[model samples]
Target: MPKEKSLVKNVMYKSLLSLFNIVVPIIIGSYATKIIGKDGMGEVFYADTIYQYFLIFGAFGIYNYGLREISRIRDNKEKLKQLFSSLFILGVASNIIVLLAYAGFIFFNYKGTSSFSIFAIYLFSIFSNLFYVEWANEALEKYDFITIKTIIVKLIYIVALLTLVKTPEDYLIYAGLISVALFLNNIISFVFIVKDIGFTLKCLTFRRHVKYLIMALIMANGNVLYTQLDKLFLGSNLGKDTVAFYTTPQNVVYMINAFIMSVVYVTIPRLSNILAANDEKAYLKLLNKVAKSLSLFLFPAAMGLTVLAREIILLYAKPEFLPAVPVLQIFTIYMITLAFESILSNQVMYVKKREKVLICFIICCGLFNLIAKIGLTKAGLLTPVTAVMTTVMANIILISLEFFYSTRVLKVDIPIFKLDKFKYLFISLLFIPITYGVKMIFASTVMITLVTMILCGSVYFGILLVTKDEVVIAILNKFLKRA
Candidate 1:
C-alpha cells in the first residue's frame, strides 16, 4: 500500500507521526512534572535511562540495520520474510539475555533503592522493543500504517495517563502506563506483519547475520555511550532531581530535533537505493537539497530555543527547574549540530556503506563525552550544565569528522558549506531579536512562547520570500503549483 503512495503522501504521514511523538511527550512531561515535581520526574527518567541501556542490547541496531537491509530486498517477498524472521529471532534471543542481566544488575546494585521498582517497571519496555515491527514497515515506506498505529496507541496512552495518573505517589502508575502502551503498540504492529509479510523461520539462519549484526551492535554501543551516558552519569552522581532538571531542557531540544529529522529520515531508503545503484548524481542532488532544508529549519529552531530557554522552561517545567535555563541555552546549539550529524550519519554515511566511519566518529565522540562529563562533574560542576556543554562539544567533533570524511576522503561531491547556508543562517539569526522584542511585551510564559514562535516564524519566512532564497522559492513553487 505504501509502495503505491507518492513520496509527499508518505512524508505527510511521517510528519504527522513525528509531530505526535513530540506533542505527546510535551503533554505528558508537562502534566507529569506538575504531579510528580522535579525529583519524581527525574527518578522516572533516570530509570528510563537505565532501561534504555538494556534497550540498546535488545534493539541491536535493528532500527538502522534492519531498515536498510529490508529496504534493499523489499521487492522480493521470500527474502523479506526470511530476513525479518532472522532479525526478529535474533532480537528475541538478545533481549532475553539482556533482560536477565538487567534484572541481576538492579537486584545487586539497586536492591531496596527508591527508584528500583520504577526501574523494574521500565525494564518491560525491552520486551516491547524486541517485538517491534517498525523497521520492516519503515523499509517498505509504509509510513501511513506506522503513523496511524502510533497515533492510536499514543492517544490511548495519553487518555490513560490523564485518567489514571493523579499525584506524585502515582509515579509507578505512570511508568506502568508507558510500559503497557509500549507492549500493546508492538503487539498490534505485529498483527499487520502476519497479514502483510507473513511469519516464518523455514529458511532463515541467524548465524548468517552474525557479523553485520555485531557491527550494528558496536555502532549502537558508541551511539548510546554518548547519548544516554550523560543521564547515567548525572543520575548516578547528582541524584534524580538534578537529572530531572537536565532532562527537561534536553527533552525540548530533542523534540525540535525530532521534527527537523522528520524530513531527513524519509530520504534514507531512497538514498540507500541511489547509493546501491551508484547514482552519484542523484545522491549529490539529494544531499544538497537535504543540507539546505535542514539548515533552513534547524537554525531558527536552535535560535528560538536558545533565546526563549527561560520561557520554555517556565512553560514546560515548574519554577524549581529555573536552573535548567542555562542548560537549555547551551544545549540549544546541539539542535544545529545534531541536525547535520543525523542526516550525514543516517541518510548519507550509512546509505553509502560508511559504517566504519560512523563507528569511528561515534566512538571518538563517546570517549570525549565520557571524559569531559566525568571530569567536569568531579570538579564540582553540576550535572545538568556540565553534561549539556560536553555533549554539545562531542557532537561538534562528530559532525566535523563526518563532514571531513564524507567530502575529502570519500569524495562524495556534496557541498559541506554553501553561500545560501550563510544567507539562511543570517536570516534565521534575525529571529532572535525579533522574537525577543515580541517576548518582552508578554509576561505570560505561554503567550510569549506562542506569539514569538508565530510572529518570528512568519518574519523568518517573509524574509526568505523577499530574498527569493532558492530553497524557499523551490519549496513554495512546488507546493503552489501542486495546489
Candidate 2:
C-alpha cells in the first residue's frame, strides 16, 4: 500500500507547494526589502534567527523522527495514534523550556536593541511547531491536503504582506504578518490532522520515543548552526546591512534548494518503509530515481543561478543588494551539495538508523563553521560575501563526509550517482555561455535576466528534449500524456 502511494503524484503536489513557497517569498521579500530597506530586513531576520534557536530546541527533531516512525507504522491505527500522542507530549514539554529560555535571553542580552521587542514578539513561534502536524501528514503521504492548505495560507500571507507592510516603519507589522501566517498555517494543518485521525491522548509513552528524540535533537542542533547561525554571526559582526546582503541571495538559493528537496522529502517515508521491508531492489531503484530527479532539476537551477546571479539579486531585491552577487554565486555550489546531502542523509543514512554517523559528521561541520565564521569575523575577513563562501565550504565538507559514509562505511552498494547525471550537468552548463552572451550583448538588467532565463532555459530543455533525456522525457510523457 505504501509503495502504491504514487511517488509521481506526491511529487506533483509537493512541486505545487514548492512553487508557491519559492514565488511567494521572492515576491513578498522583494516588496518587503524595498519597503523595509536593508536595515529593517536585517532586523526582522536577526530577531527571526534568535527565534530559530528557540525553535530548534522546541522542535527537538521530533518532526523527522515522527515522520519516519509514523510512516513505518501508518497502517496500524492504534500504534500511529500512540506515537502521535507521545511525540505531541514531548514537543509540548520542550516548547515550554525553550520559551522560558528565550524570554530570559531577550530580557538579559537583547533588551537594548531596536529588534529586541520584535524578537520578543516572534518568540511565540516556539509553540507553532506543536500545532503543526506536517510530519504526520508527510508520513501519511497526504500531499494533496498539505499542498492545498499551504497554498491558502501563503496566498493570505502574500495579501497581508502587500497590504499591511506599506512603509519602512511597518517592519514590526511585517514581522507580525509573517508570524500570523506561520501560526495560521500550523493550526490549519492541525485541524485537518484532527479530521483525519481525531484526537487521542491515551496510551502515550515518552520513554519509548526518548532515544530517537535525543538523536533528533542532536541532528537538529548540528543543522541549526550552519543555517540559522550564519545570519546571527553576520548580524553581530557586520550588522544588518551585511545580513541583508548575505541573506538576500541566500534566500533565493534556499528557495531553489527547498524546491528540489521537496521531492526528496516526499520520498523519505516511502524509502523508510522500503528499507524496513528489506526490498533492496525497490530501494535501489528508488535511490536511482531520486538521483536522476535531482540531476534533472538541480543542474539548471544551480547553474542558472550562477549564470544570472547579478540579474537575480537586482531583480529580487534591488540594486542596493548588488553586493550579494558573489554570495549568490558561491551558494550555487552549496545548493548542489545540499541537494545530494539530503538524499543520501535522509533516504539512505537516516533510514538505516545511521544517525550517529550523521550526527558526528554534522557536528564537525557545525563546529568548523562556528570557528571559521567567528574567527573570520573577528579577523575582519568575513564580509557578507566571504561569510557566504565560508558557509559553502562547510557544506562541501559536510556532504563529502556524508557521501563517504553512505558509500564506503554503510556500503549500501547501490548506484547513488548515475551516469545520466553527467548528461544533465553538461546540458545545464551549456546555458552559461549563451546566457552570458545575451547579457553582454544587451546590457544586464532585470529585463535581460528574464529574457536570458527564458531563452536559455528553453534551449537547455530543447537539447534535453532532442536527446530524450530519460528523466526529462519521463516527466514530460507523464504530464503530456494526461493532457
How much is the lDDT of residue 445 in candidate 2? 86
TM-score of each: 0.95, 0.96
Candidate 2, residues 189-257: lDDT per residue as tens digits? 888876776667787798878888888778757657686777887787778788888788888998988
Residue 201 alpha-carbon offset, candidate 2, angstroms = 2.7
The numbered model that scores best in lDDT is: 2
Residue 428 displacement (Å), model 1: 1.4
lDDT of 2: 0.83
Give the C-alpha lDDT of model 1. Answer: 0.81
Colliding pairs, model 1: none
All candidates' lDDT scores? 0.81, 0.83
lDDT of 1 by residue, 288-334 (tens): 88788778887888888888888888878789999999989988887
